[model samples]
Target: MLKLVQLYVYDLSNGLARQLSLQLTGKQIDGIWHTSVVVFGREIFYGQGISITHPGQSHHGNPLRMVDVGQTDIDEETFEEYLTEMRQHYTADKYHLLDFNCNSFTNDVVGFLTGGSIPDWIKDLPSDFLSTPFGAALRPTIDNMFRRPIPGAVSTPATIQPTPQSARAAINASPDPALASTLLQSVASQATLGPSSMAPPSQSTSTVAAPVHICTNPTSFHNTLKTHRAVVAFFTSATCGPCRMIEPLFDQLAHEKTEAAKLAGGIAFAKIDMGVGMGGMVGSEYGVRVTPTFIFFLDGIKKHEMKGANRAELTSQVNMLLFEAYPPHPHSKVTIPALEKVSTNPILFTQVPKLDIVTTKLCSFVDSASRPIPNSQTIKHTLSSEFAGYLRGQFSSNGKAVRSSATPQMLTKWTETTKTLVGHLPPSQLFPLVDMWRLAILDNVVSSWCATAAGNMTDPIQILIVKALSTLRSSEAPSTMRNYILTTLRLLSNTFSDLTLAHHVLSPSGKRSSVTSLVITTLLHEDASVRTAASSLAFNMAAAIQKVRIEQMRAMNGSVSGLDEDGEWEIELVSAVLEAIRNEVQNEDIVHRLTASLAFLLRLSPVYESQLAPLLEVLQAKETLQSKLEKGGCGEQGVQNNDIRSLIAQVAESLLVHMAWDNTRGGGIQHKTYRDCEQCTL
Candidate 1:
């Protein structure tokens, strides 16, 4: 597998040179250059010595720039050996202020990995500075500051010690004992930093805001309390054994409530250790004398307190606190049986085509475009080689294996390349690109990146889909637009893989206007393929809403209904879907999905009887669907047809029979007994 390589550039002077260089050195020096080679999730740089850390996590703070160097196909074992061998040439004692420094090390690594070097501007910064007369005068002062070692200066790699026995045993048992042994010695001799490379990967790849906030001082504690509408504080001390026993459970609660915790005025989790430095002062202020005390705060005031490591009580109190802060919606009081039984999983189109063929078709489209994009040959190579290799390695046919996500640097390069090609290609020729993206998004990493790319303003995937849909609606060549429409719908349906993106796309103002309009328009298209694809998109939207309601119902307990809180949008969806079903007479598959969409939209809805039930009455949904049941395709032609007929019958009964029965009773709508109603029966 090929790993992406990037050059992380940092300023050692931290912008001081930018402001004071003219006054101090009598020359304009933008920064004191510091660079690192970022690959394999580790940032490798030389400073007082060599060090490794998670990218962007060293003491230098965030990087000034992340330049794409290239990629390396070197195996992990071989790369470790290379780094071990490079250590002898770049030893700590031989380091110099101007000669062999961080930039020198990065340049060598870049050349070794990609047969290329770091940018010339960065590599020659020292020369550029020394060329000025003023810079030449400060040479002795810089040398003294770095070379005149003070007492108790931190030791370098030459003074390292041996590895532990347990660790050595584990290394010996590893598949490649020699590689593991070499890596351990290298890490021990150099300053090993961050988490262990051999540690198991985390299960979740989605980047969530830190679920818990560690507060060691009064200022931070007060700030968190004032910001969040609800706060849960777990106060403990180092010497307390019960505190250790309950810490994991406390962390579990924080992660469980992370979604609500990320809202603007949402709840927050804070941890305070009384045994630690300013932690004692903060805990004392709250009259906390015992370890493992739990406190609940609302609007920055104490509301409740518990005084033990009781797991059950902690869980219950947290739930009640959440319930108090965000009460169940008013819609939760209604009852609708048919809507309750609807499935919550969205309908996804996940058929994968041969990636090699897709790459060929895409390259052909780009090769023949009137204005070719820059780097056309390189782009084709990436599609056929690196991109294809990445997807194939990450996904398998059985689909049971768990895989890690692409690194941020890799994702950045892929998006930039794909976005350029997409912008230059015509809509009619975008089918292949859209198909590739449809498969790419099945990987959650790409889906998550596209969802948050530039806050969706310049999201490449969304732009591609919108452009294709615009063409599908207006194109005179129906034959040419068929595949485009089909792939575009599948791409939209796949957006539900990340629920955050799915909800945002279906938001009141975001993608609603364009996506809903296109799906509704295509629902009545002449081609059966277009209609099938459109129905799948419609079903996905409904299923997403249903999923949220079901989750809300579970969270709030079964006493109330689960509501999506958007009545206007639901009404529009129901109207469009009912019309589509009535007009769709030939395809049982299309009717099946459309009927399921209706069932999900009206199911467990807080306003089903009030808003949706009356809309059903106005549309005469019973007569429309009963006629569908009488259509020849809905008869006993096959097992699938019978299932479709049964679904239609259930939907009509819940929508029309319940509404008519309530109207006759002169009472507002209520959940009536479910049975065969005369107007609608399978």
Candidate 2:
């Protein structure tokens, strides 16, 4: 069920007293100083304080007025967690009248939960007022005075209104009609969510993998030929030094062609390395045993061939053939490096205990009688000893080994149960469901499924999870739910990147899973938690890609350039992360994750060498610009004591170390993790 939102506005005083205060304070807006967001039916309120208080009981008494701010789909548990996280930044001890205050907190909470911020007039009022000369002059005293709440109000929700709204009318709908109309014209959207966020759960799911044809499968290859695209076969030998030498370039072309072929149908490359089994079959089929040979096929007909290491000739022929057979694509448009062949190793998922005892106990934790997810309440109604014993049976390890009770079917049912309760259940209750699923994946369920089911022609783990995600992604996900999803995606990608081989990552259907798409979307999500998780996932992906690429390069000797593609996902991942960080300047929480992501991404060279140095130069320029603005805006204190300035300095320092490492390579950063800057002691 969608929840209701209420914006509680408090006025400092009424009539001319309001005008007098603004006059003395030297601001256009009257003394509507404090705001609290009340989740009406839930009896929950969230506002800034030294800490969060439950039941919406605290603040400047009952608000003078409550404005309906539309509805939000966030469950109570989700909102509670959101409020909890908000308090970490806007804590009671940290509150400042001008900077971190009650009103600012409300706007953030309202914006995150509902997607629209509080009224623009109210949201901007404080910032605008503080920017004024008169308001600026008195800021220091106000900051000191309101650093902490008054002793009495800190503990108990104040029943008394701290200020009055009588003077509010004088300035609002006041004696002056013109001023009143302008100030009272509420600035808000029809709804904060975009049309897409409101889009109903889609019946459509892109579970089908993309296709690529292999050499042994002439049927698949024959079918691919129907597209009239050019296919290049690079026949190489294990003993041939030159074959290894040109292999990276050929592989690079293959990766680029794979992408290019998708949009414009230009070309595709298939590795026919005699050292690998498939290459021998192709070599024999073509009556060619020579290493370093390039065979081009267009419309199922062999059109051309290149022998020896005439690199220029091979490249030129393939280029011409591809252009003629398929539309040309400037894949060099985003030139980085190309990916190696997919690894044949199965991405074995790690496994763990089901811990049935804990899960069964949690079944009764929520007040089920109140029923959060309307259609689902059976688990809440029945606390049967029999069910508890059954759950316990799944976890019993007594002297003997406990037999596994967790299966794909069981997990699927559990997921369906949890998902149905998502909007209906509070976030606190919902997180456990996500955790349970994650553990199931960790306990080798994920790996087992990927091996047996994911690559299968039929639906199994991938389809089931994709359908579940479809349900999860269909609505305006509450912050907690989004947080859970982001965390899950991060975990999944991190594991997949680590354990899954390149071949295993590819589906038999000739396409890649939509997992990357999921991560990218969340990386750019409106929610900061999701973005943070996505950034962290990128870091893991880059590391995994680099590890595998390095391993492959090592096996190939010095033939391929030391650089294979810098992790398949890093280039795009870093680009997205950088864009988000650049856009969300006010969100201080994102900086740490962005800096961490950049640190890891910078570990990949050529790409890192190309990108990091210029980034340092840009960071230096930004620092200089900010230093100038702050000095110009509010004197030395503004320049010296600013949060953004401080954060900027830290980010620059972090990037500086990376640039230094980039220039020096790994010599300076050895044994130095991100936490202990290469220059700093561990």
Candidate 3:
């Protein structure tokens, strides 16, 4: 056992310091000798003391003691009067006599000189004597005088000798004091204190050297990017499928691209494994939640960011940005013609028929609806026939010729008629017309024209068709109309699922609900994208929910077993959906939604513990199969690391309670039935 002494000293005046030094060290000293001191303007005001009693001694060899001290300023007489008052009211012990306040002239010189039993009068002194400035100063010194050093003290000098110049270097040059203190405390049991306790160990032991790596400061990644032309950073995780997919591509670019290779220099395309180490910290700092995220930097400043895995698109964008920064050929900026010149020119403008003619005819029919012979039904019949005829004419050969010859002004007239028709009809009637245009007219009759005029359409009429269908899906539209809307959504989702077009339409930040609604509706879509997207969403959302559960578990000081048994099942379901989508990229949104749904089930269920084993087994099997395929065969090493088998065992262990109950119910059966099987060997 070792005795430890902790000293806290406060000095308020010079006289007490001299007296305390004389009494504790048996000598008059000015500076620290064997003790540590805290000076408050040169007065010994506070101190702590410790003493170790040897084995079989009266104090019983318990090797620890603690003392406290405080300092104050007061005249000797006043102090003595205070001490007398405290002695009468507080302590009347031998220790109290040792702790007292007095001036050099009036001090009990005999008590200071002789280490003997204190007088009864002195023993009755207040324990609060140390509260005075003089008493506080003497307290620590008195306490430390009884302290015993730690046992088995050994002196081991530093192995590596420092030069005189090195010794003069700043304290931080070696290692930070805080870090060194931590290292010392961690290995104190194995280490020996010496005069120069700050020095490194004398023995050239590898075990001692291992901690250095843990203590070394991490390299500053941000600082190294300053001199590079363009910094390309890849954010990835060990478990991210897209991240894994794009990693090799990035590696190829890092090796092949001349400028990129040069920029990489000795950095060697370092990877931040977001799964572990400082990588997680960096990812959090940069707000990275998804993997396969690439950040492009110019002179250490982030210029562009791409999230999700599109290797080719990422490469192209990087190349384009680099070209802009360092172009091979220079060209003058192009200027645009004045709007007035283009608008007023005869080549650009052409007169067209007015819509009033059509509007007047339609209004006249409406007015005649009150008559018995031709009422509202008759009026509607006439308008419908005329509108259909006009629309049919617009789709004929002559209509094609007129459209071909039409100028921007004439096209504008046609657009106005379409807008008027859309605005005049009720939603109930307009939905069908919109569907007809989308299905029959847009792709066949009007596609080429629309394609040519796409850039010029200030407000996209085609998007209007999508909007009308979307409205029908949400409204109390007729079942037939709703089915048509669903069909339209399915067609659109199918057409855009494999292309970047869906991403453009479904981005949460763009065109408001146009894309969001598209994605949400597609989650329920018959197409695979619906399932795929749903699964992916579900998986990501599950991770978030599980993280919350983990935090709750930690707050409650719960065991990991409870978390694994109950919380992990939902996580597994989400993970499975994500894994499925990773393999089947065609219907990602549907996959996301499916994953999210499973996650919801897990979140709402308390029987998650009961379901955990089976879920884990299934996931483990899938993972094992995937791993084996990735490795090309189930080699001995591969078989040994079969994750599914291990997970099954873990599940069995977690459900041991239920298994034990079953065993108990079966006439105290101790062995499982499988153990006696002919094919089994135990």
Candidate 4:
């Protein structure tokens, strides 16, 4: 009781017809037939008919010319030629009339022909077309054709059933189900099989876990290891605050996740302590200027990477990879739909929710230093307390208790809000907020907080706060506050001097006293590290001053014969400072500062040897110089006016002796023999 099936072959050709003949009868068909019936079991299958006629002819012209066809038309003679050519090109046994398209047609045709009773051809088709040898080879080619509907066509029963299965099989075979799902989900609703149901069981097991080996150095991991299925490497540093925040998350992931734990077996997780291990060489190798960079490897080969402190982003990427490796069960009751196929008008995906939290935290730390406090007392408080109340609102300790965190963005909002708050306060109270920021530079915790804040604040006022503290000039600040100021200023100035207000302060006359005080204090500071910082700052200041002077001199060169009086005054000031420095060069702390400063000066202005000669003389004459160096009882411990006056006379005498030699013209007693007589010592 086999049923007759209508086979609608599309874009049919002689190749398809011959393939069908061989598949059905195991014998090659020799000639073309316009309409034909093939019998398999007790069923009869009819292919679509084709008729060829002369051009411009009505239904009947010279006689209806019958052409070879399965579903589409072909000329009778052309069909015969095609058969001959295929027979010549392909061996008799190798040639088949049916490729994948015809084979698909056969399955449906057999099913219909048998009246829903499975035909021999239907029974012969592979149970799992995706895994079958023939299905694997031909499934992709068939799938592509079925995705787009044929133009100017209506769906027929035969076309509807076969097309979708082929298309779905191709999608299921892809390596990345997420990517494949993304592509296939659009048409998935129309599909008989839902997305979740199609996924194989292997895709369900991948979950990211803790890393195995914590390599202090990644290069060592690369050097030591030979083969690994996957490797996760983290680049971090101890001083990087963001790294500190993210390290716990990375540790937690490595410790708990099965995949990360077994990474050593097939995957390996490694870490690079950029501060100590690689000397930051690995960072350069990986183009990681920032901390908390994660790199993923497969078979010890790098495949993916991300940088930043967002734990969720890292986790999302890890989860995506894990699911890809171990897909959800295809037959599972719980299923996730495949992603939709792409369209020109694609739907945009919103970013995950957790990113906002991460951004808030990062922004909070960046602007922490510049944020104005409510009062002076707040400065003495611990950082956790200053922002504790704020933290209570932003985070949840156990998903049940919501807390606020003083993030940079929140702080910025607070700053804006506080402007209104300040309006209610007396004008006298306004300056105290600025003072708090100044005080923050001293307390290590506050200083670190400020440093973190500097990284986040976008508002000009917040930026200015960081800039001011960074460039704080010793002379512009009150003397009582100067010591604390220098220490805080040193902390910032040593590392971020280029961005600090200290550089700008050195450029102006009004601020020069502050600059001078800073330099002097640095040179006299008891701490070796502080002395070093002061010396460095002094060098930077001197270089800046020299540059300004050079530019001014260049501008005035042809216009004036003598040096500008203002310029001369600046030089004199510099010389006086130099003299003061030279007088104190014997103090061990000051000596290092002076030597470093002098070296910087020598490098900066080598041509000013004559101008610098006196300072050099004092330095060179250390033993006598120290003995003669008198403290002016002026609270400052260095040379005073009397010391300067005596040194100048000694210099003048030296000049006079030289002048006398020149006047003598190589002979006779010098008119004035300048000598340091015992009376001068008195």
Candidate 5:
């Protein structure tokens, strides 16, 4: 799969959400739309817009529409890591009124996830909102509110808020319990304990905050006050009417403690019931004889106190908890050299192969006297050129040609002409030329200009191969012509394993450039040899992808100074290869090639292990594939190439090994663990 994606479209103007927005703001909200990107239906990524709201709860309750947009091969953990690194970029403070708003966010996210932008109708809504008089005048209010969350809007009644986790949760979740407790203790004072325990910080404020636990009795109250970094208690009795009046506000403050913790001790809000059970003893120990009293505990000491129902005093006091817990953002305090480092390195491409024998065996050129050809002079000049003459073995039998005489410029010109020439020329004309162009990329034949060819955004081989594949797509095209085109593409693809080139070559823009789409189409081609050729192409693409993936990984390990240019195409490239293997075909040789290619990809990428559905299907449904293999047996011209069952077994083994390994962690292949599998070998 290229990218697996589901879209959540929350209509901000719908139902009570819209009514409340209007009722509170006294202006019609054109729309308060929010959307999130859900990957694999487990992890969610969406812009919350600028609001005091939890993700997906846009004051709108449930979303109006949730649609499946696309599919991806990136597993949840890797994708989530990317989102974590980019957390600050999507904050409410960075939200914009007209430009960088939620819709724009959906566009960026959807484009990255699916290679397809969100619909223009949705993206254009914010600008449309600004065109109106009311929207234009209310921009400042929206912008100001975006900079700071509105009070009392942090939690939604419709959404179930997750219970706050103590450091204990971290300790229990980790495998090394001893180290886990130690590490958990270290971050307990500062870090938000879980991905969902997110609110410890709001807007520009960065501080550590933990949940407030209600103390049931004096003993529990003592542990809470001593263990927690900050503590607050509302001393109330059955007779105090004012204490009862402010109880709900106290509860809300307890729930939303901001920047209120420093160490292993965390934030707690306890109530000492003055009239019952331990309530009387707790009140007496704290010297709280009054029916209602407030105590603030910081670091095991009484730091502040309040008496009576003073809501304003309580709010002001609670707000100061954050400044006490968090340090200012380091970026706001100091600049560092590490953050500004940039790299200077040259891009490298493979040394091209000397294709003399391979080129000669693949194609032969002769003066076709039968149907007098057009462009005979240009064709022969290209064919008989010094570089081509030696590369094609058309020179003297002494294995010599004037290759030294042709400059890189002349050879580059010949390659350029050859690419366009093959586009409209008969496929029969470009065999020797194809391999020669590939060789031109090698150090022996190429100059620095050849490297420029790739960097300058022109990949002759990719361009030529895509054009040939496109032309051969015609249903009426002769089987011989189709086979010839497929062979040329396979040969052209064999020479480059560079992902930088693959990025442009395999970009999923359209049929011509979308390498995966084209291969899938060709697998459906009638000619068995053409299908076989496409499978070979699949193998070559897999090899290229694996090599590039390993190299990129090593570069990242070494801290090599370069952006991971391959990340853009890694998903599409893998999808095209795996999906091509999964596409049904009659040729067993095709199946073998596809299986081998898939095995190669699975070996290189741990992420693809989760997407083993197609592979697993081939193994479990033996009866199903047996019929397919028999039907897809040898064509009239040849005997059965290879046993499809054997090929299926090969794919099954590749999957079983990884799935079993991954199973050790929990589950895989539809969440079925190795222990769960009756036959783990399969």
Candidate 6:
């Protein structure tokens, strides 16, 4: 008999998610979804891992929505066997609220029974929540909660295989708490992960072998070897008992080293089954005479071979290979407290001016223009009425609730209208319009809509910001239109609100050349306000870069080689910031922000002579920032310099104290190579 499968969806937040999701996360989330499969007269759910009870009678009560998910022909006995296999993966200790939860299990079950997936709105709760600034900030805190140990009998499940007692005892006995913490966190984090934390269970199975590459043919094996700097090939026969015994350990090692391999070029773990198609040929070519042979290949050359399935030797050899290929930085041994103290959050300019006043000022500027600018009356009305109403509904005031989010149709209309107005308005009069957009884009909904590419593959937000920046090209722009320039800089800073837009702006895809020019020019502007705005923009970009570096370093266990390959603007940004630091004798606020930007850029960068160190050396960064530490520099002549001076000194110390220039070579940092660094040795 084909049994009916229904999906029961519960709202973990009751109705509070709908009531306050927009206010908190800038998106309308109906609920924190919890789902289960109702089949065979039972409700099967995952939390403390796959539990069953009578229908509509789990700890979560009745579901808000019951989805009829077709029928399944598989009998209860076979289904139970499937559940038994699943128990190995979905143990109580492996359960995570966000990463691997009740919904993930049901999605997998639904896929198995019906060969169809659940609704995106149901499965996409984590991603949709994470898209907002508030949601992104809350993720680490949430993950940390699930990282704590489960209580009582909840800690153990029959199907779950415990980590080897030897490995656990070694890690616990280690004197270095940091090492133990790192190893423990890696295991804990991976336990709840089903492939990526974001992917659905059907798309991403719970397997430590997610990163491993299986090579069935010699062509495929050679391709894997060619691409990776390091390759570990497991030569195994289908009937070999030792190979079966050691297979799980190899998968675990692959999972552990996956992130490091990605950072340090590429490392691949390949399994070649001698009994499978063309696998015997591969083994013969590698001179593998034994069934359970393991070969380590570096740069396409066979480096070492081990005969037996010795787990300790295999683990030690792989670690040694990774260290040889991608060594840790020498600077990792040095302590830089100041750099560690720097926050990586992007600085945004979200100050909202009164919509009424801003609209009035815009109208006055257009109406009072010496010559009538194009689209003046139409844009004025659009700003004062249509856009004003939209902004009012989007932004909450005096604790009043924001209106329901704008629909796709409304957003499309606004996008078309804004694009038209931007094209028609004179470049000189574009700031007020751009300023309006600056406020609008602060609303995450509007920001997402604007960042999206239209049919022609052009982002409206990118175009609008670029147009505002182009006005700076005019010779008289700095003095004649300081408000326009400052407003544009502020808009650029706010672009960081949407990570997609911020990434494009920082990447080669974003008209980075124009932005670089704006930063270089505005940082030298005579007006302190203009310089301050530019400094904020610079800091936002630096924060984004620093954020990436920090994440990559963490993934690699604190051994990143350099900035991302796309960071072409690093040199220009460093030079421009250093030059600005030298010229700015007023505005301590600008000086402080600029120094922070410089510090973030320099910290944890490649210690090689060819990289940023040469530029910092040529520019004499230490001396330029050192001058600001003296009394009555970088601010008003009479102001007390204690606080600002102390801050500047810290930045200078963190950045410059370790830098040593080769005086004989004219202008380059003292060169350091990976091979000579003892700290990098495994």
Instruction: Give the winner by lDDT.
Output: 1
Best-to-worst ranking by lDDT: 1, 6, 5, 2, 4, 3
What C-alpha lDDT does candidate 3 achieve relative to the native structure?
0.34
Question: 187-285 in candidate 1: lDDT tens per residue?
Answer: 222222223332222122122213566555565577668768789999988789999899888888887774433344577888887754356778889
Cα lDDT of model 1 overall?
0.67
Q: Per-residue CA lDDT of candidate 2, range 1-682, in tens?
A: 8778888776534333265433232334555556667773433332323233343444344566777777888787866665554443333343444444555556556655566666766655655654433333333434333333343433211111221243232222112234432332211110011122222221211111112223322222343354445777777665899986886666555555454443233355655446432335557777776888888888778988788887778768866775555321111111121112222232322333354544554565445625554434554432223323333444455646444544444443453454454535544445444544444444333333333222222223343335336645666555545645654654454345324222233322211345555555666677766666665555455455455434433332211122223334445555565655555443444543454444444433334445544564655433532342343422443334344445445434544443333324556643322332433332
Poorest lDDT segment (10 consecutive residues) of candidate 1: 200-209
Measured by TM-score, the strongest candidate is 6
| RMSD after CA superposition, every candidate | 18.4, 31.6, 32.2, 31.7, 23.0, 14.5
Cα lDDT, all candidates:
0.67, 0.45, 0.34, 0.36, 0.47, 0.66
How well is each residue in 1-682 modelled by candidate 6, as lDDT tens digits?
8889999888777676686554344457788788889888888887655677788876677789999979989888867866765665555544655656676677667755665556778867876766554444444444444542333323222122343443332222222223433533443333232212222222222332445665545755776687688999999886899998898889888877865544434688888877654567899998899979989989999999988889999999988877766666555554545556656676677666788887787678667766656666776777687777777776648557456554444555555656665565565666666777777767666654443332222344556656655666655645567777788888888878877557546655344666777888889989988899999999988888777766667766565664234344677788899999898887888887888888777766654335676666677887788888665565545224466566577666545543343344425534443332233322
* Per-residue lDDT of model 4, residues 1-682, tens digit only: 3222332222122333243322211223322221211332111111111112223132211212322123313333543443332222122111112221223223322322232222333222322222222233334443332332244444221122333554443333222223333423322222111122221211111121213443333334553244444456788776789887887777666654432222223334566666643326666777877778887765555667898988898877655544433222111111112101111121111112232343343234333434544542332232234433333333324566554423334344444433432333322223333332333333222222232221112222234333333434434434444444444334334322321233224423123444455455445554545455565556555544444333433332211111112333344444544554554433433433333333323322423323444454444433333433445212245444453434433422322111112246436533322233222211
What is the C-alpha RMSD, rounded to one decimal, of candidate 1?
A: 18.4
Q: What's the TM-score of each model vs. the native?
A: 0.50, 0.34, 0.23, 0.23, 0.36, 0.63
lDDT of 4 at 196: 29
Off by over 4 Å in 6: 1-210, 260-264, 361-382, 454-457, 566-568, 636-643, 657-682
* Candidate 3 residue lDDT tens string, 207-316: 11100001000132443353345556777776788887886677666544432222222122334556533455666766777887777766666778889889778778
TM-score of 4: 0.23
- Where does model 2 exceed 4 Å of error? 1-429, 450-483, 501-514, 524-531, 557-572, 583-682
Runs in model 5 deviating more than 4 A are 1-379, 390-407, 428-458, 497-512, 548-588, 604-606, 609-647, 653-682
Q: Ten consecutive residues with minimal summed lDDT in candidate 6?
A: 195-204
